[model samples]
Target: MPYSRTDLKLEIQTHFDKGFSRDLKILDVGPGAGMYGGLLSEYSDILDYSLGFELDCLEIYPPYIEKFKLKEIYKNVFIGDICTFNISSYDYIILGDVLEHLSIDNAKKVLNTINKNNQKCMVAVPYLSEQGEHEGNIYEAHLQPDLTPEIMKQRYPSLKLLYGNDSYGYYVNYNFNKMKETLVIEYNNLFKKPIKPIYPKNEFKVNFIKGCKFEVIGENKNNYHVEFINQKTNKVIYETDITNNMWTKPSLEYFVDFKIRITDQNNVVWENKFNAENKRVYIHFASNAIGDTLAWFPYAEEFRKKHKCKLIVSTFWNDWFKDTYPNITFVEPGEEQHDLYAMYEVGWHYNEDEDIDYNRIPSNFRKMPLSKTAADQLGLEYREIKPKLSFKKNKSQISGDYVVIAPHASSHAKYWNYKGGWQTVVDYLNDKGYKVVMITKEPMYDDWHDSKLGGTLKGVINKTGNFPLDERANDIMNAKALIGIGSGLSWLSWALGTPVVMISGFSEPYSEFEDCERIYAPKGKCGGCFNKVRLDAGDWEWCPEHKDTDRHFECTTSIKPQVVIDAINRQLEKTP
Candidate 1:
């Protein structure tokens, strides 16, 4: 009755290892044999007496207090039952292996009493242990013998599991501070946890700054000055001089080496630098565009390897890379990302508000190739890395060597606007003993212009219309080459290892992969508008320079069919 289990004692010590750091008062509720009091005294000595605590104890039996030398170990010992004792306020109250001896109703009342003034409390309970009256002491009997972890959680909803195993669990009241908002601490079923919290001071707490947003919290931010700086640039991204109980800010860059410094009223500066090593880091793809996701997905793996952290990734096309990237954990968008040390969102952000935006990249994203933009944002090596696709080649429905062409783009600006360009190329490929297959979702030319420039390409095999990406991938894989605009399908064709003849007047020649046979007509025309202008998603026919004139899409329109035909011929010659 006076001694605690060796394992249970070690578990309780682990809590103290992470819970508090300032000099304060601690009340061990039932220090029957000075088991907890002696442990606390040892910790006080280990931390040097300056930051140690005033250890006290409350015991029902007066004889045990003297027998266990509670008077020598603790500064004060109150001889009374904790259930009926008029408890005074303390910084922390421990009910280690003592709650089961009291009735459920009395235990609840005691917990409510100690939860005043935002006081913190911890409890250690053995779920399956049962004990009768020990040494003829009635108070030592287990009154609530059927208590389990589920029942404890049901009774005290605010108690979060701090550390535990199947036999016993250590829980702490998360409403520890005086602030109205409950402190958030993430816990899972894993053991061998992070040990960073035990080294902080008692004034204010800074939650792990991660996942695009961060929060600095305390009872009040009266004279506090907080600054978040980009370590690499040595520029202060955010600075605040005391206004409220909490301060928060958001960053756009997916990966930023940040240094957070806080100056309290006493001029004591507390600073922390961001590190993702051995921590959980999340990378989210903000775009549903297939090409964009594939372009950026490989960088997630690169980030994981470089940082040596547990990486979590979310993308629209998770199945495409889930099997290929086994080291990364694939999650859905909006799923709860718990206890992340850092998080980054990768996408093309245009027309962002200067006052609030934290600049996701250094310059106009259009200046670099598609995939390199992600590399820049995530602070990785800038190279054209092709993401591996998970879809396998299926049995071909077509009999012979074929050519795939995706003429339609999401916007008309991305289309090959040259009049009758697709028909000429389709005819050219068809006559050259290669079966041309159209893979666009639309069967006819139906964009903002509603022009009849491309309709199943006259004599080619029309495989166009709503097919799965896997099936589309299979068709492209078996084909000799693919001829299309600067769109997602072109990116997919490149990823599938099929040579692509990419035709575009709107974008620069180096906008896509370096190996693609790029066809562009830049003579006497305004071109590369997609990268130059802030794209308006609402406008289907968005020609920034000349939308209403005939030169509206001359970038692609002026691209002669002969140029694309020559590119295709070059690819065929090389592959053959």
Candidate 2:
């Protein structure tokens, strides 16, 4: 399955045109023929080096190798298994139409290997369906694995599927155009709105009107005023007072080009163009809560006529929501929450009721399952949110001097206190001439600096809370191996397919989804705390009978530093 030299040149040129200045080393693993190597020879400007490995000697013929001058281009074309080949040095690796020949297990193993090594790669396979049969009478060695975009996504969420062209022999590019476009649109929409205007009711009334018809209708002491103005000339024409909420008939000649501005006790509530000749659409914002009322005002103003009902929201979030979404109607939480056509609650708790009728609640109030009780009431489906971090390969340096020790968790309750084990491990690694880089939060810097164990560690770099989320993920992805407590970073390392040693203090390793090898706290009375909810002091903090007292550091402290170093050595030995 060889692509034409012209097509390969065009692909390389496309990457070059997009400012891909970094050296483009192409790795054609299991290259059936030296045709791809020959294609690279046509584009010397873009191709810095081209290497191919084939299992059979027949694939790399003497004439073919001699014609391309394989040795001169540093082609390194050889006969070997792609599984055994080290691919961390290559910028781009291609596995075209080779997956169908391997067994399902082997295919998975190969994919895992490719993911572990290559930062970016292109994989292509024939579009095979259960009903369809292979048209080509090729070798019997080819065995198809169940392959599709959906299956691939399930196996490798980070590997984006790209459009393939038939001209390239069933080749799919790895570039993610749609996600990039979405990010660009989101960035542009951030600057679309301007700040809103704030004016007092009395100030607004004095600036726009003079006198108006005033009347006290209800128990409230404030008076209702109807001020008249000429719309065409922008001049106050007439004013009057009425005790009841009724309009007074004006002379036909005086009513032409007239408008009315209604003011509340301290602010202008309503304004309308009162043209008798033509009917006009009206929109209003109302809410039970102060926060909801403020948040809905601006959204109502922006899309008032476009919607059938007032754009109502919770009044509690009005101040913050107003800054971003300004045209919504705000309503209070508990005061007979009804008015808007639809309602969206930010934090809704679920109550236990399998057959509760949601329709009984007003269509306006947005229902969301915020709590476990609410989720039960609504029969809402929920999933544990996985850590997803996007990373770009830094080609600046293929290798580095330092070993980063990333330790820190968002919550103290979940974090397993490792005591001084990290320092001990760092001291051991540092003694072997490896610089230690510790990734943690700023608050823990003093803790690490003041420790007696820290004195033994040399060439230590503290990247505590300095790197961005994605960059931090990238750092872990490129690390030799991560040795840390069971935090989100451990989950991230598992997702990235990196070697990790999780220091489980109060949790069990078997409870988590399997991805990589893990070493957990030695099993005892206090182990396997798999309960969904947090436990009380007497309840099963780890086991049913184990009571959490003043001393709860046994799980973390019991695991020796030598044990961690041994685990690291074992993982490093296994990882290619």
**389-488 per-residue lDDT for model 1 (tens digits):** 8989888889989998887777788888887888888888878888988887776544532363554357778777789989999999988999988888
lDDT of 1: 0.74
For model 2, residues 1-576, the per-residue Cα lDDT tens digits are 222223233343233323233356667654443444443443332333331222111122243344333444334665445556666677666665566656667767766776676456666565442222233313214465456665656655545554343323233334556455654454354433321211111212111111122223221234545656766678766655433334443322111235666565646656755321211212222233322232223333333333333444444333434444444444454545432222223222123652322322211122221122222211223322222223454642225644556555433323444567777777787786566666654434365533423333345675666566556666776777676665556655655567777666555564443444556666663543433333333432333333366445455556677878887777777655
Candidate of highest TM-score = 1
Worst lDDT run of 10 residues, candidate 1, spans 180-189
Off by more than 4 A, model 2? 1-389, 396-402, 411-418, 448-459, 530-550
User: On a 0 to 100 scale, what is the lDDT of residue 133 in model 1?
Assistant: 81
C-alpha RMSD by candidate, in order: 15.0, 36.8
